[model samples]
Target: MKPSKNIVLIDSSRPIDRDHLLPLGRLRDLPEQIKRAHTVVVTKCPPEMDIADMFLWEQRLKMPAGIEVQFTTLKYADPLPVFPQEADKRYIYSKFAILLTSIANPRHLRYHLLSFYKISSDLEFRDHHNFSNRDAGKIKRWALKHNKALIITTEKDAQRLSALTQLPDEVKSRMFYLPVEAVLLRSR
Candidate 1:
């Protein structure tokens, strides 16, 4: 099937291996099959990323010659408290934070966290994990234990939390989410 335009976006941080994660890592189409793409985007690029990074990926992805590769970076915005009424203090990342993440690749968030905050603790969950009562209990314990630590999560997780009723008010009050935007870095 032919499409009007073909743009392939591959995560820049994906480990270069077909069997990296079994079924999840398996590619639907081979590099040769995607040679017709008009644009190949390297998503989740770091601010310090260079054009040279594309050269390494070229050897790994084995793309067709002259396929334009564009780099994209995630720009983070200020942390927004989940419960405005209860969370009176604004998040100041320079203080302390405990990262709670349930995403495929959290390195982008981790990068921003490291730059802006002193990480007190980090809790990683399966991608798209739904928080339960027990999960909330654990989070509350951590937050209360680390009196000064601000609980942090991604905007996606924050969205998911909004639908969950099991998490305690205490945990919700302290939790905050950082919003991020993907910006394309035009090639020179």
Candidate 2:
């Protein structure tokens, strides 16, 4: 049960950060793993990433001379209703937002939203955090205080939020999630 081709993926943001001092077993063996990969993908890159940075990533990751490296950035889609039947589309036009995220890296989404909304409050949780009743109550309280603000979450977080049946109708009506997709950056 082996694939014909092996691809290795790395987060473009990792090598530049010096804080993660712990040596992961896989990180220690990345060079050897890259040697076996047919392609190497650098993910979570900035959309404006240029060829020069891509080349630098190769050097930083110790990519072999001939291995192909491709860069990808997460592209966010327009806000979609978390609960379509209860959602009010006008909330999308709000000038303020209450950001709710439970993912590893939310900076990308926050950056994108900054262009459209003045974030009133940003609530972050560890990656894949389950929404508890207390959490929903906290969010509901925030949404109530910022009456005109939209409640925005990631598509991943929306799935967990949607499962909470106890969320108030007012909260459900203003909730939306941004869908994100990874797009390859091409050198022009």
TM-score top scorer: 2
Give TM per candidate. 0.82, 0.87
Instruction: Write one digit per residue (lDDT tens) for candidate 1, span 49-163.
Output: 7667756766676666677767788888888877666664555543888998899778779878887788899888899898876787777778888767778899999877666
Pairs that collide, model 1 = none
CA-lDDT, candidates in order: 0.75, 0.84
Per lDDT, the best of the predicted structures is 2
- Candidate 2 local lDDT, 61-133, one digit each (tens): 6766677778899999999999998999999999999999998888889999999999999989888899998
Look at candidate 2 and tell me the lDDT of residue 166: 79
TM-score of 1: 0.82
Q: Candidate 1 at 111: error in angstroms?
A: 1.9
The local lDDT score (0 to 100) that residue 177 gets in candidate 1 is 89
User: What global local distance difference test value does model 2 have?
Assistant: 0.84
Angstrom error at residue 56, model 2: 2.1
